[model samples]
Target: MEKTTSLISKKHYPILDGLRGVAAIMVVAFHIFEAHATSHLNQIINHGYLAVDFFFLLSGFVISYAYDDRWSKMTVTDFFKIRLIRLQPMVIMGMIIGAVCFYFQDSVLWPTIHEVPIWKMLVVMIIGFTLIPVSLSMDIRGWQEMHPLNGPGWSLFFEYIGNILYALFVRKFSNTALAILVFLSGCLLIHLAVTSPNGDVIGGWSLEPTQLHIGFSRLLFPFFGGLLLHRIVKLTTINNGFFWASLLTVIVLAMPRIGGSKHLWMNGLYDSLSIIIIFPLIVFLGASGEVTGKYSTKICKFLGDISYPIYITHYPLIYIYTGWAVGSKPSFQEALPFALLTLIGAILLAYTCLKLYDEPVRLWLKQKMLTYKPAFITVK
Candidate 1:
């Protein structure tokens, strides 16, 4: 039941693309509600953290499908260059947005923002533009995030690691080896998720070791699981794929917290099962089908297009919204309007960056950085 595409003619998995957009929006909602709760136990979008895992999974699958076969013409350098071209522009824009909104986010959460010199903040933003994680001592905003200005850049940081790993080594592994790697990583992921103090896989932003552990645990499994899934996929047709797949994605993400604090492992079990089992199924179904009608096609295409921009760009606004929510202590009913505005603002901002900055930068990079062909055929 696997869908086939010729090596020359790349197939578009619009449903997967749309599912990614669904996950991205779910992340925005999760962040919007995240400020109200002190812990993962009470967050309204209880499983929203899983969206990162979903994203890693999706990236693995898409990367494998897109590049696994192109090693002949493409070198590791070429691949990295292309990836930076595709992703780094938005990374820079997200950081810039954070800086632009920095003064406005001066709240209890970042009480010392007024004290942080603009030159220092600019230095951090410049480092962030390179996607480098800074130490806590150098953390200007005091959130301990690798990229304080744009929190989600941590995921993109690990994403770059995944890309480097794939380029250097993982791509050379046999399917059996990849499966073994996936298995070991899955066991570690399950252990980390289940045994977490908060009963979730909701970390990896800081430079500290524990956060690094949480981050890698979250990264390795779904990402390698996705790589393995792509390797062993048996795609089957699904009717109305865009709707059903998107629905399933939202439901999995928006589910209530699985286990209460007393039973943290219960939620851990849920998180592990969702990551290990359910997400791959969703990905399979998404890949099995295509968008049919003009509207569905357009919806999927637009969603897919804006998904990355929105996910990367929206979180800085979340920092602002979360700060406001925490400081003002408004009821959900009262804050709904601002939350809605934040959501709309994020979308508009991402779309604007996409049109005005990201697209042009990537086009220029493709022309200048990625135009040269590899001189030697060195397929490992």
Candidate 2:
């Protein structure tokens, strides 16, 4: 059989790599100017973190968009192998990084600034490595714990679990669309809890005080939306799927007290639906390559590329960097610059891992374990 095309190289979809750049920036901006109280940009920046939803959706869409057709031909082993290689190395590296930082400071928050206990340090490190947030605890796994570092990293647990399930049952379902929509509805339910009484979105969705552990149910849909949107776009072409729908959703978002506000329960899902629409809209436009070349170029994509590492590192660091009055926290003015500096630093570090560590380590493992069939190499 012909060697199947690999997912790694630029030839498959150049636009998405560029698009990844966009996602990274939105995340970064959320920490920097967007969420910065000094700039008073919180209206967008606070909400801008929602772009992480776009990333999740985009991941889902891209995964299914790339491989859904080949599901029957792919093996369970190959599926898992590729995912492990793609995810685990970064997770390990992030944990190591978090551990080292926690050790340096001894405490990440001011109240906790007296010092982080060795036991709390171990638990925080464990969460970072495992990617699962502490569930039943009142404080959640990564934050409010004694040592607590890297709150953003918790989402990966769900990402990994969801991918595994998709490989097993959901990926090849005849009613894939229905399944995705249903999953989306579940996320909407979680969204309802996170909704403020005033109707503004919360920093993160968790009906149960903190969504870290069990929040997986809600996060599942962003991934599903991307996957579903991918299929919808393939069926419809760029003609209508991504761009138009995304715009519509955003407009709907601006006036929260309107159409969606009434249904009100699934506000998280309602707003996230806009993300699915917006991401494709950006992709479709970027595919043209005309806009960024002329304008909208300086910040968005640059921030997007580094966004993940920034997101992973920021929250946990907040305690370390700021805090004088017991969880009063640092205002965005003081925190924003430090956040950006740290964000840029993380991107450089994560790149080194992606290039020097991740690829080499993955290649070595794949060669050692897998059958080495070219068709099985999803990320060549």
Candidate 3:
């Protein structure tokens, strides 16, 4: 006789969830600040882009914790199904939101926005639904972003790559081999950060060779390093881990650019060190933490829930805000109220999608796709 088995749901690290929410909020602030600043060096929330790196670290750790031991029962197809159910609903909603708001974002900043036809925009939106990046030749926004409809979708593109890599090969590696790969990737990241003319790990949105290098460099080390960290380091209990970890996250992401224009490498060093050292520490702390009270637990739950929705959905609004700022040429003080409104509006919209669209769709997908019948084998 054979027995049927069901996969057990994994426990979540609430502190990590809370930290993710904190980082997501900072990303919104970073983009909002991007409208006022002329360049990377002068931008407020200077290191906010590093939130993406921090996210990758979190993703690797979470994925490992969730799936590493399940391969005995989980097929690759099942793994992809779970990821898609968890992630794709929001991605589709983000593209639809982008397409809906595309024309309204027309401004002198994006000169060709007015010239692009509706059908072309729809084509881009449809492509975006699939998350296969469009080449610059097809770019409608003039930003050369992989997904013109949703610019930040570029990171999701790399995110898919990471997932594929993990499912296919990295999942099978020994801890020692994994550590070697992580070390080499770390070197590449440091080299890219220090040597780039911009002096940061910022350029992963485009299709060009240089940008591709930056994208992979941004993706590899922290992701695999997080995996390595999971395999090697044992978790320890910590008091108030969420508060300290969140404080460190905010400080690292909000710090001023180091070295200025003359010593760009200093900022590069900061980026490298933050990714290679500080981000892992934050994850470790978060993983080791416990959500102590009802208030704290609820706060963590709310933030964690909205983190991805807000990050994926807010940029379309930012496009509109950027257009208004550029065409009106408003001072920072003049733009302040609108910026606050934009931030508030984004949070509201994200929450609405979470409740009305993402949750329902994901639930439906899980019911439809994930309800696989158990397979039984002959007893020995």
Taking the candidates one at a time, how many backbone clashes does each contain? 0, 14, 0
Weakest lDDT window of 10 consecutive positions for candidate 1: 371-380
Q: What is the TM-score of each predicted model, taking all chains together?
A: 0.94, 0.70, 0.96
Q: What is the lDDT of residue 94 in candidate 2?
A: 70
Q: Which candidate is the best by lDDT?
A: 3
Ranking by TM-score: 3, 1, 2
Residue range 93-152, candidate 2, lDDT tens digits = 676766665566543333232344667657757765766555434242333432245555
The sequence of per-residue lDDT tens digits that candidate 1 reaches over residues 34-124 is 8898877788988988999998998888888877877876778778887888899999999998887785666787845578888888888
Cα shift from native, residue 139, model 1 (Å): 1.1
Candidate 2: stretches off by over 4 Å: 1-11, 33-44, 106-115, 135-147, 175-214, 235-270, 283-319, 322-340, 372-380
RMSD vs true structure, all candidates:
4.9, 6.1, 4.1
Clashing pairs in 3: none
By lDDT, the better pick of 1 and 3 is 3
- Which predicted model would earn the best TM-score? 3
Position 313, candidate 3: lDDT:
99
| lDDT (Cα, tens digit) per residue for candidate 3, span 166-240 | 999999999989999999999999999999898999989998999999999999998888888888889999999
Worst 10 residues of 3 by lDDT: 371-380
Between prediction 1 and prediction 2, which has the larger lDDT?
1
RMSD of 2: 6.1
